[model samples]
Target chain A: MGSLLQIAVRNVVRNVRRTAITLAALLLGVGVMVSIRGTLNGLQRSMKESMVLAQTGAVQVHKKGYLKNVLSSPLHLDMEVGDALVKRILAVPHVTAVAPRILFGGMVNLGDQTLFMATLALDPKREFEVCPKRRDLFDARAKAFGTSADGMVITVELAKGLGAKLTEPAALLAPDKDGALSGENATILGTMQLTSPGERKIGIVPLPLAQHLLKMEGRATELAIAVDDLENAPLVAAALERALGPEFEVHTWDNVATFFKDILFRQDFLLSLIATVFLVLMLLGVANTMLMSVLDRTREIGTMMALGVRRSRIVTLFLVEAAVIGVFGGCLGGLLGSIVVAWLHVRGIEVTMPTSAVPFVIQPFVDVLYIVKIVCLSGIGALVFAVYPAWRASRLRPVQALAGG
Target chain B: MALVELVGITKSYELGRTVVHALNGVDLQVERGEFTVVMGPSGSGKTTLLNIIGCLDRATAGTFRFDGEELGDRDFNDLAEIRNRKIGFIFQSFNLIPVLNVTENIEFPCLIRGDPKKALRERVRQVAEEVGLGKFLAHKPDELSGGQRQRVAIARALVTQPQVVLADEPTANLDSGTSEQIIDLMLELNAKENVTFLFSTHDPRVMAHARRVVHIADGRLVDGTDSGRAEVAAVAGMGAR
Candidate 1:
């Protein structure tokens, strides 16, 4: 066993140039995935940071049926109940921070100009310690998510579309089931910053005013909690479920983050499918190198056979050489990929948007899981590539092989 | 006692509409300590006969008995075992593994035979010394001269101490001087180890070293002697073409 391993190592070393070429292919493939991972993570960070100014924390807990049937239903009547749940869940072992949230949706009218949008209400006092937005993000979401002195902030895009701004009297009208407009009206006290039009797509209001406007007095929409560590999110989620009991559902950052789960999955699958072609090509490069090696040493192999080297052993030698190339390449690729990803995670990729998406931010990312994923896949890459060449080498006839070229 | 025996061995291949007989009902016996030389023109089945004796080919229509075991229809493992344990082959091109040192190249046969460690090592050491490669055990095949390569191949074959060593045109790839050197080494080794050496060659010098000679043409053994030639032609006519 040991001698075979030694021979396998020697065979790889003998073709140093090809081995280097193969290793480079493996590394480059792994590196691409790693960088993609890092880039995505950074985008998420930018999103969450923007969200903290809007909501705070990774997870949110809302009243039963509030998320699914918010527009028309039995509204959560008490903000106190949500506050209690937030306090109790934050007490859960892995839970780190907690904040409350409220939502309001209505049509805004600037004179005769009217636009429909949703609104969210948050406590700016509590938001400061968790995810305060940077100057650029704050300035943007302010127009879409800003609060007024009357504590009603409107999105910038919504304001422009409605020809309404701070201190403008924008009629907040929503239709009840009777086809009669609720006839609610309020002054646009202030304008919120905009990170995304989607964020501004929601009107901005203080919690008390939002509770009044939504006709659900003293009731909050949800409680947001930050956990001690991001990785412990699942464990913390389960614990919160037990603590909150069957009456209220516990949620995590990943849960709401997955509002785009299907979309993300489709995106991920599309990316991986495209990336696999490169992986296959890289594997082919490895297989091609080994096949060429076998062709060049046909006589040597024949001689080995006459010297009583088993056919299986000869095949194993090539396979082992490929395996060695795979293992080394995998490690190097993973390392190179990981370093590149980690760098991106620390220093994010900047992105620009076309003029149409103005007032909406798009951040690119570095996801650590993506790096881990590529490193793990590199081993399988090497093994699969080496199979054909090794089998070919093993099947050579001793007599014909011994015959010189 | 004979080390190997072949009874009515025949082999053929079909090419388009033609049936080519590589070996045709050939019968022969080789005893221990004999240098048997088989000579033939190309496509005359000399190499095919060597392939059969080396356990590298199966006889299509005959019984081949080696050390009391019938050859043919054995699985690859058994056939490989027979080659490793019963016969050692030296090819015309001095088939030494290019990646291996001369000593490791020689030790390969012993390794395949699964000889005990102490025994395998000692055999490799002794063979290397005997083949005049004691100092070149670390040198790969390409680094050695043509004659040295053949000697290394001879050492590889004899290291396992198999029942017979099959040398199929062992000097075919060597220059005249190198070929002479290789043949002399084989003769000296045969004299010392008493290992039966069956060589298939067209080289006159190789035939000179053989104690007994087997001649073949058109896939049938022929005697070059006038009376024997007449008998072979009469036998060929008595059969088919």
Candidate 2:
């Protein structure tokens, strides 16, 4: 058996050019597989981080019916949690900080321009406990975020649309809890960037001002919680749910960002579809090459057959050759793939939001497990594709083959 | 029973819509140690006869017995095993595996039989020396001359020490000098080791070296004669020089 394998190796090496071509095909398949897998995973990781960093704070707690009818931003669905509940939530083991917030839909009036937008109202000082990065984002002075102050932070795009500047007064009008219309005038403190769909018109205000205008002074829409680690969001959400009980709903970042979740699911589907296409093409190429090899050496096969070589051994010989190609190709592919993935992983891919709808540098992640999967997939695919050709070579009648080619 | 026995053998090939009978109702026997040649014109079923005797192909409708065992109805793999164990083959094209050197090709049959490597190597060296290929054992087929390649094929056939060595038009592609050398090597191996050889050839000069000449035409045996034995004896006398 070892001798037979030696012969198989020699045969494969003897036809260097043809073997190289087959190897190239296999290597190409594996290379593409690794790159695609890395990119998808990296994009998913980046998107999750972006969601957590921007709007959701790892986890959130809201009134029972708030999320179901969240698009309407109904004041009646707001949570009436007291300071006692906030103190209790901060006591949860993994929870690092909590900030109560109110969400409302209203129109902001600036001079003659009026822009309708979804508004988030929160305690500016407590906001720093959950999202410390907002300090750099809003770039506001100390007094602008004062408690009970009538101040707001709007997105850069909204500020440009409103032609408003710092320390300028903007009027906000909305329907309050008793179905009466109310309005308030607030000064714009700063402008910052936000990238999700429909987030261009977002504006932030002090929690008290939002409560006063909406006639829901003692209530909030939700409480955003920041955990010590993002991975512990689900656990923290669970503990908070157990503490807050039936009236409240706790949600991890992944659960709250429905758009991000759908993109991730679609990314998975796209990767599978692409990988399958690459596998089938590689299989066809390897099979075609092997079949051509069998045809080219018909007389030699007959010679071996007449020299008392078993048909099964002939099949094994061809399979071993294919496997050599696969093994070598897989190794080379892995090396090249790892280098390319590492380069992209370090340098990061600059892509528009069209790919995953998140504008940022997506650094592709190359996992060792994904590399292992690529090698196995390529090796197994080569062996499977070689079967038909091997069987055909083994089935050649010694008499007929020798008499002809 | 003869070492090789073919009684009323017939072979047919399917060519699309028609069946062509390549061999028909041929009867012949080759005893141990005989250097037999099947001589006929082209398309005369000489190859078909040799294929059946070598167990490379089966007779469509006849009994083929090797060493008194009937081979007409054995399974494909069993017949392959019998071929590996009991017979060796040489082709006119000097069908040595191109990738393997002379030594590797010579030991190939024993390798197929799963013989121990160390023992097979020693046996291969002995056979390579016997066929005047001792120094060329490291050379590939393409690197050798026509006569040298055929010698390697002969060594490969004899290394197995089978009961019979079958060659199909073994000199068809060789020049006269190389053909004469191949015939002399076979004759020497026969006289010394008593390794039975059954080959097919149309060349009258090759027939002159065979101990027994079995003539076939259109798949039937026309003559089995000992007339070639006189020439064989003369060649054996001059072989020592």
> Candidate 1, residues A99-174: lDDT per residue as tens digits?
5666545677778787778765565555443444422433433533334433355655666777644565666665
Per-residue lDDT for B1-241 in model 1, tens only?
Answer: 5679888999887889999999999888786766677887778899999988887767779988888778777865677777887788888777666667887778777766666666677778888888888888889888888888888888888887888999988889999988877777776776667777888888777655555678888878884521233333343333221
- Listed models, DockQ each: 0.41, 0.68
Off by over 4 Å in 1: A48-53, A71-78, A81-97, A127-131, A134-136, A140-148, A164-167, A171-200, A212-217, A232-246, A343-347, A352-376, B116-119, B224-241
Highest-scoring model, TM-score: 2
User: What is candidate 1's TM-score against the reference?
Assistant: 0.86
Clashes of each: 35, 0
Tens digits of lDDT, candidate 2, A252-292: 98888888778788889888899899878877887887888
Model 1 error, position B207 (Å):
3.4
